[model samples]
Target chain A: MTALLERVYAWRWSVLPPITGVAMMAMIVGALVAAPREIIEGEVQRLMYLHVPAAIIMYVAFFFTAFASVMLLWKRDIRWDAAARASAIVGVFLCGIVLVTGAIWGKPIWGVYWSWDARLTSTLILFLIYCAYLLARSVAGPLDEQAARYAAIFAIIGVADIPIIQMSVRWWRTLHPQPIVFRPDPALPNEMLVVLLIGFVAVLSLATWLISLQTDTERAAQRVSALRAEFDHREIA
Target chain B: MNVLGAVVAKDLKLAWRNRSGWLSAAAFSTIAVLTYSFAFDLATGDVRPLLPGVIWTTFLFAGVFAAGQSFQDEVDDGTFDALMFSPVGATSVFAGKLVANLIALLIIEFSQLILATILFDVALLTPELLGIVLIGTIGYVSLTTLLATMGGHVRGRSVLLPVLSLPLLIPLLIGAVRATGASLGLEAGTGPWMLLLMVFAVWATLAAVLLFPTAAEQ
Candidate 1:
């Protein structure tokens, strides 16, 4: 199992980039050319393709971070920590995209660039929480085991907070658009749905590629730090 | 006394000895309320609309301040290391500190409520409001205590505490503010809001219990 996994890991760098590129190109064509423009929202409605997919992938990334965090705690694995860190970083970035794209879409529709509505506010809070997680990693030394453990614990707590944040914010106010996707009734047309699926593939593939690169970098940096410490110790002896 | 009682007693004593810490928090809350009143000119108009927001925001800040201080002295004096090594457990230390912090914050909050009543000329304390305060503080202190422990050794913790904690506490803040409004007759249907607060508190407490050991481990 380990050998097969190692082989796949080795080939991922070569395999992922081209696939992501092609997927992204396909999504772009599908979104811009294939999908018919909405009669009401026009061009700005197309932002939904980007905004929705990014939002979906952002949730994927953060939830994956939470899962990795739990694995890191339970298994005592550096790889899990690396994955958590990488996913969290990617999640924060994707969350930024979600907020920005949503704001752009909102300006065309809601007459303002921002709203204190339920979903918007909760997403904003999630973004801040993960930003703080990254900040904690930097401040406490990413290589530190205690930092890793604490980060893992923090990630779990953050995930737990998400539902409560949603519930509370929801009770506070909810003006964001209802679901066009993920419902039984399926509001979107077939072409738009295909484009959205393509966007999903593209964004998720991009996120996976980024997380893989980051995980490798983190492990390599740890190796370099370990080697330096060993070299210093030997020299002193 | 067992670990929990001893730690709680020790912390409460330390907090009493450092009376000015919470006094300063009280002072900050007072200024915040006063500033809001001045800014909104609550003297003439209805302060009811503004009262819930003011109360919860003040308590939120106070919770942040108290939770930040929860681990600072222990970390600074290297007593946290000893406590971690002690036979009892991280949960005990966490619960103790949580209780201590909760007591300190409640004191500050109670004082603030009285001051609000006097300044705004409104009845601020009622049974439902106190229940909301208790539950909100529980939710607030639980996560903040865990976070404070997690961030104790990190750099820029003073800044990081609020940055790390306030976002997590948004649900609590939302629930508390809305519930406070309801309890004070500014709004109706406090049940769901109170349920949110209770749910948040339970969630935070369970997370702390499950995570504090790892967070405080050497």
Candidate 2:
């Protein structure tokens, strides 16, 4: 079982991107051609195919960050710190996509580029927190263990705020429309549902690919730094 | 408890000597409120509806400067290292600083409230309003102090402090504004907002206590 898992993990880098590209193309075709227009929203509602999936992917990225951060704190391992850092960077990128797409979707529908609606507000806050996390990591000084520890702690605290923000925003109002696509009783027609499912799969794959690539780069950078330090030590000796 | 008191007392004395921590916060709050009052051209009666948001927003910005100052003193004087090395555990240090910030923020907030009443002509100085202020301020200060400690040693700390803390403080802001609105009779129910404030304060306090030691460690 472990060997099979290892094989799959090894193949992931090679396997993911192509599958993600294919799924993404399928999602686009499905959204634009196959799916019927909404009775009310018409074409603009199609943005949900990308916008909702991006938002979901952003959440997944942050969840990975929080998980990796906790692992770093518990294990005190540099690898875990690297994983957390990579995940947070991707999380921030995905969060930006979520916000921009959300604004684009809101303009025609809400009749304003922005509104103080709860979901948008909470998502904005989430984006800010992710940016802060990256800023804290950068300011912690490169290769500083204390920086990792601080970043880990900040990540944990920031993640804890997510649920509270959601709850508070929900209680504050129902101004933001309820989910129509991913709900148990999905309001989407069959074709739209199929497209959305493809979109989700494609986005998740893309996120995983990006995170893995980032983690690899971080690990390589750490290795180079360690090697440089060792070389300096040898020269001194 | 004794150690925690000593920590609070020490911070209070340090703040007293510096005097600028809370004073600048108060000044900032006053300037912010007055500026808003003028910029919006809000009449006395018009100010009543805007009171809760304007006051809370002012406090949020003022608290950032105040919280940043508390750690600036420690870091500049190299006392942060000393405190970390001290026999007193991290929780005591965190609690002491949290209490000190609470007192300082409340002072700034109250002064701001008084200034708003005078300048904006809003009657926001009632006892019930003060109660909401206490709950909201405690949660805000607790989280800020913790974030300040984390980012205190970083460059551009004044900017970094707010960036780190503001997102976490949103729920507090929402709750405080709602509760304040309810208290001022601008809204209907205070119960939910007050409960949110209490939950936020407790959660922030607990998170800080549990996490500060790890964050403070070298």
Candidate 3:
């Protein structure tokens, strides 16, 4: 089990990116070609393939941040902190993409680039929370354990907002349309569904790859700092 | 319970001695209300429709300053470390800060309400309005108090507090504005908004209680 796990971890560095790259290319081409246009929204609805997946990825990234944060707090392990920080940075980046793509999609369909529709507003707020988390991380200094601890707590607290944000779309009177994909009976056509599934898988894989890369970089930096501190101490001795 | 009360008493005493912190918040709020009323020329128009939003916005902005003040002295003087090192737990410290901050915010909010009424020529003083104000302020302050604790150690915390707290406070703001609108006869029902405010308050309080120890250890 351990050897297999190690092999998978080692392979993640080389094989995952190319696979993700191919999947992304296929998703884009398939979304543009194979996916049927909405009768109402036409070509503009195509943005859904990117926008919805980005939004979903943003959620996934933050959830990872929150989960990693919990682990950090419980274990006092720097690796958990590294994972949490990397995921948060990636989460914020993906959230920004979600917002931009959403605005692009909304401009043509909603007749305005921005509105206080419940989903948009909630997503905007989610983006803001991510920004705040990053800010908290930045101001605390990189090597500060207190910062990591506090950030973990903040991440855990911040995630409680997600479910509420999701529900707000339904509970409130919103200009945004209700879910057509994940409903009790999905209304999405088969072709669009297939394309969207591709988009989801591709984006999710890319996000995972990005987060792992970031975590590895952060961990390496910490190791370098630790070695430098040791060398300095030896020289002083 | 005693620990909580003692913490609250100590905070209230500190706030009393350093009245300028909350006083400045109130003064800032009054200026904001006056600026809004004058800028919009509320005297010549029907300002009734805008009262709820104006009042809540004033409180929200003003509350940031108040929240920042909640821990400024302790953080600056290094008493925050002392408090954390004390025998009392994080919950007591958080509860104490919450009560102190709530009192400070309510004072500013009430004064803002009075100024808003006078400036806008609207009679906003009533039991319903007071109830909405109390509930809304409690919810807002609960969340901001926690954020303020985290932001207090950060440089540029004055700016950081609002940036950190505002997004989380959106549900509270929406509920307050809607409920306040109902109180002012500009809206039909307040039940849903009140429920939202209550949920927000409970959630924020739980988050603060659970997170404060980890946050305060720094």
Candidate 4:
């Protein structure tokens, strides 16, 4: 376990730019091809190419939190907790992009910048919740490993709410559209399908690059924070 | 019957004598209610519809506000170590802390409900809505009180409590909001809401019972 752990950190950061570049190029071309030129409402759905992929990426980001939360509880692994923290930073960025693009999309369609629909509300709540998690990480500031530990416990418990947050829309009569999740459309016309697939891959590759960078930064920061604390203690003594 | 009661009583004594401790919770509840009223005023004319949701949210936050002081001062003052050596089951200590926090929250909840009615002009103060609020409050308070104790041991505990508590409170929020929405004359069937409330209560109580000792030890 120790040997494998050593190798994992060794490779956490050296592997993503090229991957994301290729993915990004693919995404640009895919978007151009799929951009709706003439429809009842055109070009606004252009935001869909961006918004849908970003939403999916946020889900991937949250899964990192859930994974870390469980690992911390099960094995008391601080590394997992760090990964969770790292993911949250990335998750927030993705969630913010989703909200922004969503607002842009809504302007052309709903004639407003925002709505209190369930998805919107839940997404906002989800963003706030993770932001709360990040803020908790900052509260103890540098040199407080306790904050990370507490944040880990929080990450574990907080993920349990996502389902409820997601369901709260349909559970009650909320303005949010019902999830198209359960009933699968038998066939997507190839154009939409291809665009969505390419879009997901592109967003996912970028999310990976960002998540890796985040994890590296968190761990490095933790190290610097601990050293600073040690120096402070020596000076005080 | 043991030092649990003594510790509970001790923490309450500590908080009450501080003056700020007592008012911090009251102030939060009040501000929460005010903000809630103003936010609702923007959209809907009837504060009655949103009253119970606002009250429960206010109390949940109030509980979070007050619960972290659990053994915080005791820990800081170095009195907590001695408490551990005293003749009390950690469970009793937890119970006492949890109870004291609950008392503080209840006071805030009651005051907020009254002030909300008077201020928001929610004239229809039904016994039924109040009853639903009472049940919802119990479930929300117990979970928060316990979680606060657990999180309080961490550094930046003040920030830690809400991070942990809010997610756990989602089910309670749903039950409360749905129940409150129903109480406000929506078609909320009694059967489902009550079941949701009970589930939350049971889950929260069990966690508190199990972890009270851990919190005490921490």
Tell the DockQ for candidate 1.
0.77
Candidate ordering by TM-score (highest first) = 1, 3, 2, 4
**Which parts of model 2 are misplaced by more than 4 Å?**
A1-8, A230-237, B43-45, B151-153
Off by over 4 Å in 3: A1-7, A166-172, A227-237, B151-153
Q: Which window of 10 residues has the lowest lDDT sum in candidate 1 chain A?
A: A135-144
| TM-score of chain A, model number 4 | 0.86
lDDT string for model 3 (A144-188, tens) is 787788778778878987765555443565887778898888998
- DockQ list for all candidates: 0.77, 0.70, 0.56, 0.31
Model 4's TM-score against the true structure: 0.79
CA shift of A79, model 4, Å: 3.1
Q: How is the predicted docking of candidate 3 categorized under the CAPRI scheme?
A: medium
In order, candidate lDDTs are: 0.87, 0.84, 0.82, 0.70
Q: Which portions of model 1 miss their true places by more than 4 Å?
A: A231-237, B1-3, B151-153
Best by DockQ: 1
Candidate 2 lDDT over A1-237, as tens digits, reads 969977887887789989989988988898888888888877988888888888888888898899998888888888888889898888888888878877887788889888888898899899889888988888754467888888888899888988889878878875667878655788777888888889899888888888888888888888887888889999999
Better structure of 2 and 4 per lDDT: 2
Query: Using TM-score as the measure, which candidate wins?
Result: 1
Collision pairs in model 2: none
Worst 10 residues of 4 chain A by lDDT: A179-188
Report how far off residue B156 is in candidate 1 (Å).
1.5
